[model samples]
Target chain A: DARVTQTPRHKVTEMGQEVTMRCQPILGHNTVFWYRQTMMQGLELLAYFRNRAPLDDSGMPKDRFSAEMPDATLATLKIQPSEPRDSAVYFCASGSPRTGLMNTEAFFGQGTRLTVV
Target chain B: EDKVVQSPLSLVVHEGDTVTLNCSYEVTNFRSLLWYKQEKKAPTFLFMLTSSGIEKKSGRLSSILDKKELFSILNITATQTGDSAVYLCAVEGGGGSNYKLTFGKGTLLTVNP
Candidate 1:
């Protein structure tokens, strides 16, 4: 079955280090989303791309966090100078909404667990 | 701001019992409500409800939405230990960024044998 693949299932980094997480969306999906999950905040949307173009990234911290889709197959989220508060599970999801399709369900990857000390 | 709220932040029940999780939302130009199950990792899609009064079911798990009430309910009958997880509720609203989803805190459910 098709699934979204994420690399480096776990990561441990010191504060101020740069961390990069990668995702490979389902082959034919057109929409990809990046989310951060924390115990207190639950799941927060960081960014999303439709057709390989970023549709929104308002939820991300522009100063330190960046999300990009190098191509249809690869989407990346990078945090420069990571802080202790940045420790969380990062998830990537993809969905394909065809015409007349309502509320297309997003398929999520296993996620990358990042721990910043 | 778009907001989603889930009731009974946590619940514990014996196996074979039934449970109902509640989700309420306040959003502008509402689009749809979605349910997800999260274990130790990423949350997986469970159901998406758009129209009110339409019940969606998959085996022992079923859900329904109420547009007028601005809430939804997820029911699991004959619960199993494997069903222990956090149930997340998300709402999609229309407008400038219609594709974005607002999620609730989620209900943590534990099933004991």
Candidate 2:
């Protein structure tokens, strides 16, 4: 079965450190999304890319957070000078429009659990 | 702002019993409602409802949406211990080519044997 693969399932970093999370979306998917999950805020959309192009990153903190898809197979989310509040699980999902369907269902990876001290 | 709300933030029920979870949303140019089950890690897709009055089912888990009321319900019958997890409700809103999903806090369900 095809699945989205995420690296470094867990991470622990001190405040002010830079953290990078990587995701490998399903081979043929065209849309990629990055999300952050916290106990207080639930799930928040940080950014998304369609056809390897950045579509939206409004929910992300432009000062410290950055998301990119350099190529179709790899998508990355990076936080520079990460803060304690940045501790949360970051997930990556991919989807492609199905033939004759208006919307496509997204497939999520296992997620990277980041803990910033 | 677009938002999704789930009721009964936490719940506990005995195995074999049935439980219902509620989700309500207020969004502009609504598109679809989706349900997911989150356990120890990432959430898994459960159901997606776009039309009202149509029910979607998979074994003991089923869901229905009401476009008029802007709400949806998820039902689990003959619950098992494995049913314990956080149920998340998300709504897709119309926008540009990039469609974004807004998710609620999710409802935590615990099934006791």
Instruction: Give the candidate number with the greatest TM-score.
Output: 2
lDDT of each residue in A29-82, candidate 1, tens digit only: 988989999989988999998889998888999999999998999999999989
Q: Model 1: runs farther than 4 Å from truth?
A: none
DockQ of 1: 0.75
What's candidate 2's i-RMS value? Answer: 1.1
Q: Show how many residue pairs clash in every candidate, following the order shown.
A: 0, 0
> Per model, how much of the real contact set is kept?
0.75, 0.72
Per-residue CA lDDT of candidate 2, range A1-117, in tens? 999999889999999999999999999999999999999989999999989999889999999999999999999999999999999999999988777866667889999999999
- For model 1 the local lDDT of residue A83 reads 99
Per-candidate Cα lDDT values, in order, are 0.92, 0.92
The Cα error of candidate 2 at residue A103, in Å, is 1.5
Error of 2 at A108 (Å): 0.9
Q: lDDT per residue, candidate 2, B1-102, as tens digits?
A: 788999989999999999999999998888789999999988999998889999999999999999999999999999999999999999887576767678
